[model samples]
Target: MLMDDDLFSSRPEDPLASLARQDLDPLSQHELDERIAALEAEIARVRAHSEAVAKHRSAADALFKR
Candidate 1:
């Protein structure tokens, strides 16, 4: 099951969050580790994307100001 931690964390009022809070089948140690790794990679990717977008916006704003 591909779980998106960001989506899950962001929507506290979502029904899925309620389900997630309930005690359910747990992931194996290996699966847990893999999920953590994937989340970390996703966080890095998102950070990089945000940085690039900020850089582009800053450049555009500078050109407009000149």
Candidate 2:
């Protein structure tokens, strides 16, 4: 009974969650270091987006203040 929009709106499994469950024991030291660097970069990207979103929300709230 699901509509087309409902089917497409559902997200696939979160890759970050999948990555956390991955077996890291098999990775070499260099591989682990590379993974750490990639994760750090992703963290920075997420933080920047979060700050931008917060600023946007704050501006919207200020504009609509009663």
Candidate 3:
């Protein structure tokens, strides 16, 4: 009974074994370029918005302190 439980409890297949045999889909050069450009634009927008918020917060705090 113990041996039977051990056999059942053991992982049936290795995930890495399957990964070793898998083929990855190739992305086109155009698609890769577009994705990179989109990510850069998004990062720039987020940084600008963050700076604006920090400036507003600083102004508000100075007013409150006076």
| Per-residue C-alpha lDDT of model 2 across residues 1-66, encoded as one tens digit per residue | 999978787788799799889999999999999999999999999999999999999999999999
lDDT of 3 by residue, 1-66 (tens): 368868787667785587456554565788769867976898899999999999999999999995
Among these predictions, the greatest lDDT belongs to: 2
Candidate structures ordered by lDDT, highest first: 2, 1, 3
lDDT of 1 at 46: 90
Model 3: worst 10 consecutive residues (lDDT sum): 18-27
Compare candidates 1 and 2 on lDDT and give the better one.
2
* Candidate 2 pairs with clashing backbones: none
Q: Of models 1 and 3, which has the larger lDDT?
A: 1
Model 1: per-residue Cα lDDT over 1-66, one tens digit each: 657985577646786477458653578889778867977898899999999999999999999995
**TM-score of every model versus the real structure:** 0.62, 0.79, 0.58
lDDT for model 3 comes to 0.79
How does each model score on lDDT? 0.80, 0.95, 0.79
Q: How big is the RMSD of model 3?
A: 11.1
Better of 2 and 3 by lDDT: 2
The pairs that clash in candidate 3 are none
Cα TM-score of candidate 3:
0.58
